[model samples]
Target: MLLENMKMAFHAIRVNKMRSFLTMLGIIIGIGSVISIVSIGDTMRSLFSSLYKDVGLSQAYISIGYWIEDVRDSDYFTMDELDRLKEIFGDRIAYIDSAPSISGEVKAGGNKLKFNLSGVDYNYQNVQPVNMIYGRYLTEEDVKARKQVAVMEAGAAKKIYGTEQAVGRTFRTEVYGSMTEFTVVGVYKKEVNAFQKLLMGSSDDTGAAFVPWTLLTWPNDLIYSCRLFADPGMSREDMNQLFQEIMFYIAKSKGRNSQDFRLTTAMDEMVQVDSVMGGLSAAVGGIAAISLLVGGIGIMNIMLVSVTERTREIGIRKALGATTRDVLIQFLTESAILSACGGTIGIILGIGVVFVGGNALGLQVVVKPAVVLLAVTFSAMVGIFFGIYPASKAAKADPIEALRYE
Candidate 1:
């Protein structure tokens, strides 16, 4: 009986193909929107994990005081705020390795390359995990003694000696108003940020040259970032508070509000970023749900029209000793068929959207299995909820009335 109803349902839907397609359109759009939103969310999660690892998300770094969110905020800190920080915070805080950067040409045996030259303090070794491919990183002795020494990334090594053995090679870098030659003490692998398929050369560690921070400071500007590394077993919040205190004093000394100098731990910032993205994705999902609601309503309306058009047929079946249950099943089956077909198509379309988004946009559109299941289930619910009224109307129709009306 159920199988026969399904066959009849399909027959009815086929008879009005245009109407059926029109009804399914809302469902298609609904599913499509959901798929796109979920795909973007998955991609963002992937980007976050990958970028954080590459860019040193575990510990934050800055050119002035590291709390800066953008370039404009960084500029404000460099005027006079960073200097006052040292005077207030004193030794309870780790030393600030305000290694300013310089852009210049560095020359080796026969290779000349333009690169970003940075000066780092001894504590930099502890602050940042610079993966040395060969040799050793710059040390306190190098900075304090003003030793003619430098560190190179993989690109720099290749430019100079074409090999990691370039550790002992000397390169003359154009320094602050002078030409200086520093022997390469270390060579490190280049760092890359996430969004590998989107942004180019986004990592800070890529193709960099390093000098001692003691030998590098801005002539008259303040600082850019101030990084704070917690001592072992120290809470990140405590360190953050400490950093904020320093920023607070700097701001106060400068006669500005604490907000003038942003204070945030890297972890805090990263979590907030992820949270914001998550919220946006949820908003997209909510919008998609509205489409789904409209689609469900469409299903109800179409199913009711189908029942009305087949009123005479329903009455004949009932007259031929067909029970009300049989009539009910027939109409319900038609409704279910509409939804099942729409749902299957929606699933296919959703998967297609994710595939395109992931491959074309170079994002990790990780489709959660649960989400797919939920979407499919939601479609079925739409059918059931909307189908009931129409199916009941068909079952309750008077046999004589239904046959005579049409």
Candidate 2:
């Protein structure tokens, strides 16, 4: 009996193919829009999460709040104090470095190319590893000797000497207000991923170079801050506790209030980013879902019209001993089938859009199976909810009156 009702419903839709297609159009557009928007949002969140992990999610920065307290040059971190901290927290800390940077320009072929000169030691690589394309990174000997040798990024090296392999080449930049020449012992490549490029733009014209931190700092120079990288094996709670202990130790050692220093971790930024992205996605998805309501209304209107046109058919079925429940179920089944087909097509269309857009933008596409399932279920429910009135109207029609009218 159910199969017969479904067959009749299918025949009705087939006979009015154009109208059925027009009715399904609304559902297709609504479901497609919601699916695409949600998928893009999830993809973006995943991209950012990956980027944060790649950039060292276990890393943290420490800075002095000069405004909070009267800071003295002696309160700055010294080599001996840094060594003591390392000795005490060797197991918890992976690497710590006071990387001071200066904005300088290199004169190349009558053009001054701006570059940031960062002072780093051999241990700096452990904190922020780089891939050396030519020659090698800074060594312990270079840092100990305070050699005037530098490692240039590939883009900067090419800009300076018209080649990426600019090893042993010398470039002059202002150091301590005096022109100092340094030999490039190495060149490293800085990889910019698709998402990074989208956010930070092209970094080909501007680049950075690394030098020995000892060369940049003088004896008794105040190091106001440093970066600390925690051991990857440590959990988030342990990492946070270790950071707080370090902050307290530094404050006590320097004879200042703990409030004088600030500690920031990459996880803080990650949490904030996740929150913002999730909220934005939900808000936009909710907006897109409004169309589904419109589609539901369209379904209801079309079903009402169908009931009126099939009034005599309903009368014939009733006269043949068909129950009111059967008439209701038949109409409901037709509406659900129409909506389910629309939703299936919409899912395909949405996924196609995500893949095409992701490929074009060089981004990773992520589509959740749960979301697709929910969309299908929701579309069917919408059809049933809207079909109730029309189904009931058809079922309540008097067989004698329906047959006599038309």
Candidate 3:
């Protein structure tokens, strides 16, 4: 019986092929819009979540004496405060790394490469650590002796040596004052940075070059930024309170009661990413939904016209043995098939757009399974909803009057 109704519906659609195609347009567009937006968002979210893991666990490196105009700006721990903090917290305090960021060009193997420079102490590795692929990381001896040593990141190493071994090789770094020479004490494999390509538009040069603080320029400017991982079973709340107190101490020293610095943890980032992306994601989804609504309305308009054109046929069927239910079901089936076909095609087109946008242009397209299922379901709902009133109106027509109509 279902097959028979669908067969009749198909015949009707084929007879009015152009109208059927036009009716399908709304469902097609609605599905396509949703798929495209969702796919991009999903891709970006996955990419960034991976990046966040590599960004080090939540604890911020507190700095000092910058362009802080307000008292609120000075609300963080400083270099001097970290020493006292260690005394108060002891083994629970994790690692402390104090460094200032700078850019430098180093000449190695007669090749010059620009690199991010960090003048690190012994505890630097424990805090802002990287995987060492060649040689060894900077040692306590290196820091104690104030050795003029430098370590290259993967991209810089490749540029300097062209796949040759960088360990023990001498490199020249032109500091502000004079040219300094250092032996390559270590080489490291770069971290997997998802954002590197997305932000830089290139996969090369993500590794940072490391140097002993005594050997690098800008010595006095080295403030403090510490990384404190929780102990095996310590509560995050306790860690936060401890860090807060440490910041307060620093704030007091600077003559400010409140520490004016940002304190971000993994929990904080988790909340932040959700809050920011949630709103943006919702806005995108909301905008796409409007298209679906418009499409549904278009279907209703087209279905109404279909009712008027088929009045004579409806009358003839009623006058013969066809019940109102059968007529209504037949019309509903036609709308359903029409919209469903359009939705299927739209899904394919939308996915194609997602692929082109993501791979060709490197834009983020993240499609949720739920979104696809919802799009399909919404399309069906639109079809039935819009088709219903028209089908019912046709079923209610008086046979004598409908047959007499032009």
Candidate 4:
């Protein structure tokens, strides 16, 4: 009996193919919008994770909280204290350094080029490793002796010296109103991925140069901030404990409260970013879901029309001993099938959009199975919820009155 009812419902839909398709249109658009939005959000999260991993997932920073309390010069980190820290936590720490940078113009090969000169130590490479195309990176000797040597990007070297192998070449720049010459000791490859170019524009005339921190700072320079990279083997809990220990050690050594310093990790930044992205996605998705309500109304209107048009058929089925429950189930099944088909099409369309967009942007596409399942279930529920009034109306029709009607 159920099969016969389903067959009749399908025949009705087939006879009015255009109306059936139009009825499904709203559901298709609504589900498509929701799926695309969610998939894009998932892709963005994946991109962020990949980017952070590329840079250094275990990176962290320690900064002096002068805003919390006035910091005395005596409270600053000293070179000796840094060495002691290395001795104490060398195994757990991959690298630790204070990065001091200055922006200036350098005259190389008669071209004035803008450059950012970063001061770093031998351990800097361990934290932020770069591919060396020529010569070598800064050494312990270079930091200790405060050598006037620099490592430049290969592209910058070619612009300055007409070749990527610009090792032993010299470039002059003005520093503090004094002209200083730095010999190029190494050239590293500069990487610019698609996503970076989209964000930072072109990397043409601008380049970076690395020099020893000792050359940039005085013997008594006060260090207010430091960057630290933990060993890859360290867990989040271990890293947190290490941060606490380091803060305590520094506070005790400098005779200040541990609260006088602050530690920020990449994980913390990732969490904030994730929260922001999730909220944005949810807000946009909710807005898109308004179309689903519109689609549900369309379904209800069409179902009402269907009930009125089939009044004579309903009366005949009742005369043949068809139960009201059977009539209700048949209409509900028809509505559900319409919604389910629309949802299936929408899922395909949405996933296609995500894949195309992700490929174009050089991003990874993520379409979770759970999300698809939820969408399918929700769409079916919408059909059933709206079909209730129309289905009930058809079931409660009086056989004599319906039979007498034109």
Candidate 5:
């Protein structure tokens, strides 16, 4: 009997195909919008993870004072402290490096360019491992001997030499208003994607050079930042303990509170970023739900109209012994089937859009199976909730009056 009722209900919808399709339009758009936003959000999270994975995952920074504070000269960390930290951490420490940079002009091959000149120890690459497309990275011997050798970023090499094959080429580094010569030992591969360029705030057309840390003059030289690398298997708690030990020693010696110094770990920052992205995704999805509500109202309105049109049919079915429960079930089934069709289509369209758009943007869209299930289930529930009044009204119809109506 239920199957027969379903056939009749489908027959009714088929008789008014255009109206049924129009009724489902709202639901399709609503579900599609929601799924697309969610998919994009998921992809963004993955992209962020990849961007920081190698460079930041096992990295952290230890610094004294906040940006707003007037830093005293005593705030500077000495080489002795850096060496002591290495001794204390021993094998647990992957690498410790510092980048002390200054803006300087470079002269090479009759081309003069202004570039960022950074002095770094050999371990700097352990934190930011460069893909050496040409020649080799800064070696321990170079840093130890204070060799006047430089490694160039791909963009920097291109600007000075008009090509990435700038290895073995010599460039003059300007220091203290005087020129000191250094040979380019390597060039790193450059990032060309627009998103990476914007996010990293680097112009591929610009140039930069790295030299040995010992070659940089003191008093006038200041370390811009320091990075510490931990072993890959190190846990957050272990990293925290290590940081704590260092901070406690620094604070005690300086007669300051530990909080006075700011230490940040990449793992902590990554977790924070994930939280923020999750909230953003949820908020956007919630806003998109307003359309679902509108779609539900549309379903209810159409179902009410359907009930009115089928009044005479309802009267005939009742005369032939159809019960109130039977009539209610038929209408409810019709509403559910209609909503399910729209939801299924919407899911397909949403995923299709995500894949196409994500591919174009170089993002890997990760579709959550649970989210898809929830959306489909929610659409069916909307049908049931909104179809209740119409189904009840149809069940309560007076056979006598309905049959006598025009």
Candidate 6:
């Protein structure tokens, strides 16, 4: 019976193909926009989530005196104070590391490469671990001895040595206009992800090099930012309180206000991501839904017009033993098929857009089964809701009056 009704619906649509296509346009655009946004957003979220998982989420980033000018050397966390923090927190604190960001050009052989530089302490690797393809990471002895050793990312290593395994090679860079030589002790596989690309602010060609944070002789230049990762067993509340206390201690030690510093944790990032995605989905989805509503209204108007045009046919069918329920179901079926077809096309367009957009934005693309199902179901519901009144009007037509008209 459903198949028979769908055949009649197809016949009706075929009779006015252009009108039907025009009517479906709204549904297509509405569903397409929403699905594309959702797919792309989900892909981006998944990518970042993976990155944070690999980097671990038990970490906190502390930035001190960022906007404060004339900040004294006492305002920064000294090596002694860092040691005191470890002693105070004991095993509860997994690692604390400081990194100062800078940029310099390094020369190897005849090749010179300009790269982003991170002056990191030995413990920095504990929080931001990378896959080392060659040699080894910096050691406590290296930092304590103020060794002029550096680790190069694969891209940088390739640029300098034409290979990723360039251990025991020396690179030269000038610090404060004074030439300093660094022996490359390690080469690491570069992170080739959207997050890393964005963080580096360069294409795949650019590379990052890490040297001992102690290379920066001035205390004021050493601890611009620090990362502290707590033990996994620590609760969120405890970690927050502990970090607050540490910041307070820094403030007290420097004779500055505690508010001058800021600490950002993984939990904070998680909440912010959720809030932003939620709000974005709501805003974009809400606007797209207006198109669906307009489409539904157009369907209702067209269905009513169809009822008027086929009034005589409806009456003849009623007189020939067709029930009102039969007439209603046929009309409802037509509306549903029309909407379902639009939704199917919209899904295809949306997925295609996601693929293209993902490639352009350098993010992965994904099509969620649940979201696709929801879109189809929602389209059918829209049809049914709008088709009800017109179908009812058709079913209640008087056989005598409808037959007498024209």
* Residue clash pairs of candidate 4: none
Error of 3 at 281 (Å): 2.7
Could you give me the TM-score of model 2 versus the true structure?
0.92
The residue pairs found clashing in candidate 2 are: none
Candidate 2, residue 21: lDDT: 90
Candidate 2, run of 10 with poorest lDDT: 197-206
- Measured with C-alpha atoms, the lDDT of residue 385 in candidate 5 is 85
lDDT over C-alpha atoms for residue 149 of model 6: 92
lDDT winner between 4 and 6, please give it.
Answer: 4
- Which run of 10 residues does model 4 get worst, by summed lDDT? 193-202
**Model 6: CA > 4 A from native:** 1-22, 54-56, 63-73, 194-199, 203-205, 217-222, 232-235, 252-257, 356-362
- Candidate 5 residue-wise lDDT, 1-406, digit = tens: 8788779778877988998898888888878888888888887787777777855687778787676276765566766667777887797778776646777677887998878877878877766777889998899999888898999988788888889898999988676566788999998875545455667676654567788876774554444355677876788898878878877876676577778778888888988998899899989988887797788889899999989988998899889988999999999988887788888888898899999987887656898988889889988998788889999999999999878766
Tens digits of lDDT, candidate 4, 1-406: 7688678778888888999889889888888888899878877777777677776878887877857666688777766667788789988878777767777899976877888898898878877889999999999999999898999999878887789998999999976567889999999996766666565556677778899887665546667677678887899889878878988888888787888888888877887888888888878878878887788888899999999999998898889988899888888877877787778888888888988988887766889888788888888998899889999999999999888778
- Those runs of model 2 whose alpha carbons end farther than 4 Å from true positions after fitting are 66-69, 109-111, 215-220
What TM-score would candidate 1 get against the native? Answer: 0.72
Q: In angstroms, give how far residue 151 of model 3 lies from its true place.
A: 2.4
Q: Report the Cα lDDT for candidate 4.
A: 0.83
> Which lDDT value does model 4 have at 193?
61
Candidate 3 error regions (>4 Å): 1-4, 14-18, 63-80, 90-92, 121-129, 176-178, 191-195, 200-207, 213-218, 221-242, 252-255, 265-270, 359-365
Model 6 residue 1 lDDT? 83
> What C-alpha lDDT values do all the predictions have?
0.72, 0.86, 0.72, 0.83, 0.81, 0.80
Question: What TM-score goes with each of the models?
Answer: 0.72, 0.92, 0.83, 0.90, 0.90, 0.87
Poorest stretch of ten by lDDT in candidate 6: 216-225
